[model samples]
Target: MTDITSTELKQRQSAGNAPTIIDVRETWENEEGRIEGSQNIPLGTLPDKLDELEALKDQEIVVHCKGGGRSASAKAFLVQHGFKNVRNLLGGFQGYQQA
Candidate 1:
């Protein structure tokens, strides 16, 4: 899967060309804060929610979690399921906050 840094994601967002950001963290974690416009689909529920992402199969998707683990797993799952343009946000939201 592809990887994108938080800084790069920020630039893309500022340019209004950001890819769809998917947060794979759990509901509790998401209550803290999330990147604006990100869609929350907990890692555990991703498989059942594949339909929600059907239309975005060909579009760019950036996935993240509290750290990088869940996002990596989610990205791999998406690719295996035929998502052509998926990425994992390295270091996840923690990395984003640092940037």
Candidate 2:
């Protein structure tokens, strides 16, 4: 799976070129905070939400969670489902906060 740094994501967002960012963490976790424009679709429910993301199949997608594990799994699932461009945020949201 491809990996991207939080810094790179920030730069893309600032330049108005950010891809769709998916937060695979649970709702409760999201109450704390999340990337400003990230879409929350918890890992557990992604299978049912595939259609919601269909329009983004050809666009870049960045997935993240509390750490890298969930995002890796999400990336795999996306690729298997025919998503052409997907990347896991290395270190996930924690990394983003650190940055």
Candidate 3:
């Protein structure tokens, strides 16, 4: 999967056709602020939420964290777990804010 830039995400969001977004940051970090409709699923809990996330396996999903690292890991995990379309938000939330 390719990485998506914040500018592209904002464009998709404004068009009301954004892909499903996953926030892989800690609960506290996520509470600080986040993409409007991104679902918060802390990285550590992803395995536990596999069942809950099963339905999205074939959907285009984007993952992000405070920066890019955690979300990169999340994207790799999802891909390994059979998710068909997963991408990391380039530069993550900070980048999104900057954009």
lDDT of each: 0.94, 0.94, 0.95
In angstroms, give how far residue 12 of model 3 lies from its true place. 0.3
Candidate 1 vs candidate 3: the TM-score winner is 3
RMSD of each predicted structure: 0.7, 0.9, 0.5
lDDT by residue (1-99, candidate 1, tens digit) is 459999999999999999999999998899999998899999999999999899999999999998899999999999999999999998899999999
Model 3, 1-99: lDDT tens digits are 789999999999999999999999999998999899999999999999999999999999999998899999899999999999999999999999999
How good is model 1 by TM-score? 0.97
Candidate 3 is scored at a TM of: 0.98
Best by lDDT: 3
Stretches off by above 4 angstroms in model 3 are none
Model 1 pairs in collision: none
Candidate 1 worst ten-residue window by lDDT: 1-10
Per-residue alpha-carbon lDDT of model 2 for 34-99, expressed as tens digits? 999998999999999999899999999999999999889999999999999999999899999998
Write down the TM-score of every candidate: 0.97, 0.96, 0.98
lDDT-wise, the better of 2 and 3 is: 3
Q: How close to the true structure is residue 65 of candidate 1, measured as C-alpha lDDT? A: 99
